[model samples]
Target chain A: MTSPRRVTPEPFVWLMFSAGGVVAALILPVLLVLFGVAIPLGWVEAPDHAHLLAVLRHPLTRLALFGVCALALVHAAHRLRFTVEHTFRLGRYDPAIATVTYGAAAAGAAAAAYLLLTAFG
Target chain B: MISPLEARYYRRRMPLLWWAHRRSYAIFVLRELSSAFVALFIVELLLLVRATARGPAAYESFLDTMAHPAMIVLNLIALAFVLLHAITFANLTPRAMIVRLRGRRVPSRVVLAGVYAGWLLVTAFLAWLLVAA
Candidate 1:
């Protein structure tokens, strides 16, 4: 008998795409209505916060953007270091994995700041 | 099984196999990693924008929140982190997109040009919004 197929180990980067997907999905319809209807008809300002409200009010929208941002940050941090290590062969040159690890953490923190501080403010 | 020269040759040859087999994994890692910085920078700017546009009380609220020492530290760290992320991403983009011209590897200068151009376009657009508003 054939052995059962093994699943690929987790791929985390897709989580960022997923988060981006949710934001786009929730925001897109409001954007379409604004551009397709309200803007042309002189109803919505580009700076209007109505759509922001639509997003904030929806539990699903809030969860996706915030949750995705957090998960994606960690995923991106891990992936970025991995890529840098291989691309530059920094392992051979830099001889310090801490630089890569700390750098990834820093990048991920920046992203988290953007979402939390700015989006919420 | 034996010669020092043969081992040397194999070691040099290994990078090709490593790159070919692991290229996607590498790319994914780079893209995701850059996203972290972009995400934070985006959120911070958005917050400041919303607060400023809302008027004095809101702006005061922003100051109120920023009064927290923790936030100041976070922002400083984010700024440094974003700088690192942006520099790395711009250098990596040509390969990330697999951009090539006429089957020759495009020069790094050309990729850098595209990155700067993109930065200018974004800055100009945001400037226009500020001026118009």
Candidate 2:
């Protein structure tokens, strides 16, 4: 048989997963705390709408936001794919699962980038 | 009189709800579920960016919508899940990246502490910048 398909995409995927894991773990909670909890709960003074938008308008801020969104998406996708595969015992559907999960994440990242670029432009 | 029963071979797959049986398994599932919430927040962020682009009125309206009681409740739940993800990820990092100090392996607790410390520093800096600007 075709040498049993020597090359696997898993390593590259795992690298993204690992990197995304770090980004998500380090950055996501603080972001959620600030935006989701603190501001909503009135723990911190909420930044006015215009002020926040001005920050988003910055190129560097946009880049960072895009990076965070992309990595967090990838992290979610990889974790979700593996969890579903294992939990459901979908051994035979590995390729399909990988494609759907990672593909969605890639599409999301592209969408985020497009939105950020066009919005600022 | 009852007839003797015949023995039958059965393929027993693990239960679909197997994760519920053990605390560790349940925690694992929760951690995985938290990632979905994280992704949800990112999507929300993207929407916020789009709203901002539309105009100040649109952005202000978006904020008002987000500040609604229902949205606040949803966001609070999302925050809980994100915190779960972050804590579990932090606890697991030392296992993933085994650092060495000279020839000795660094302690796992130290690695975890470093992760938290870094998170604190970044959050502080962001808060400072936001307040200063």
Candidate 3:
């Protein structure tokens, strides 16, 4: 009888990386323009406190926000992992580097979830 | 400790600044660096959410902080990096994905055009939702 093949987590990580990259590429530019530039600089009408709060309180908004934050961080982590490894010649410490990068991303995602789910409401 | 057989081949170590030596290499490095800015933007967003949750006063303060000259400059830099990330990712999507239609391979330019169309539609929808609505 053939033994069952063992699966690695690499594919799952790459899946998150791709999803995160696509989402960030598509959605983040407009958000950055609105929040960072237009609204802050008074180039566009800013959402009032109550209006903004109401939007954040919506379930769909919270979910979308959480997703964007979590996935973007994962995408960043994956890219930074290889970039740092190759640029700095840290191949010997690959395991440690991977842990630190992915760990930070996971922590950031958890923080996002907490803020979105509890703090916002 | 080098063995006789291994010593026959010359191994040249890559310079740490090799990316700086070529324009394409430099752009590649910059593209990689964009990920750091992406993370920074997410952190800022999380802070924004946290401030809003704290109350109206805190949210006002957050906006005040964002409006500061230094913060504006930093965000502008971030906006540049984000654009780089977005554009490069969009351009590369056609190469990375293989879309099939009716058992025939889809041309790359068609796929790229579709991606750009989707991006435009998404941006337009978001603009309407955030600004008009």
Candidate 4:
């Protein structure tokens, strides 16, 4: 006889964590070096104010950035959740820990969406 | 009375600084901590977008704030952590994924090389878009 199917949120959470990890690894470094270090240090010419604003106005740019921010946040949440659990031996408080970590990620993602889609426009 | 199995077993209490006891453990902890840096970078990006949305003057001020010595130093540290995150994550990708090409399985080394190559290509394109374009 076939076993009954079980549904759980664990796999979907893991999928988000994995996708976020890949996106953060591939895209974040260059963006960080340019905006965080090079331009601010005056090693590279900063993109002009009008040019930056124009770029931000583009729907595609906003959408791509939103994807990056939201995914990265979720990735961070997943890792932080486990790290806190193991490092502190807080396994008994798993439910509370998961709620806090994932809640923050969701809130951050919502903020990113609001900023990108509505506030910017 | 305790069961014979329970009485026979010994459970060692884990120390609070278990991760600090070994070099590899320390590195593993640092790798885990890198996620916080990733989150910090995203928060910075969101603030940047918000500043831009506010207007040119606010954007310029945001840039000034970012250029502050303290902010610059913080970003530098964050950069180091984020790079660690990227490199560690990329290296682990091969073990997590098994790719097959036709009838042959792709070697882990080949998969790793492909990942690094993609990283470089993406970085180059973004650099051109942001700096050269």
Tens-digit lDDT track for model 2 on B1-133?
4334422444467988889999999888888888888889888878878988898788778777777889889988998888898887788888888999999999998988898898889878777666446
Per-candidate iRMSD: 12.4, 1.6, 1.1, 1.0
Per-prediction fnat: 0.08, 0.60, 0.70, 0.79
For residues B15-129, what per-residue lDDT tens digits would candidate 3 score against the true structure?
9887899999899999999999999989988888888778889989988888888888999999999999999999999899999999999999999999999999999988887
Candidate 1 root-mean-square deviation in Å: 12.5
Per residue, candidate 1 scores C-alpha lDDT tens digits across B30-120 of 4444545445544544454456546556755754565466665655555444444445555656666556789987787787788667655
Question: Order of all candidates by TM-score, from best down to worst?
Answer: 4, 3, 2, 1
Q: Give the TM-score of candidate 2.
A: 0.88
lDDT of 3 by residue, A8-105 (tens): 89999999999999999999899889888888899998677777788788999899989999999999999999999888877888899999999999
Model 4 stretches astray by more than 4 angstroms:
A1-5, B1-10
lDDT of 1 at B72: 54
Clashes of each: 12, 0, 0, 0
DockQ of each: 0.09, 0.59, 0.75, 0.82
Most accurate candidate by TM-score? 4
> Any runs in candidate 2 off by more than 4 Å, and if so which?
A1-5, B1-12
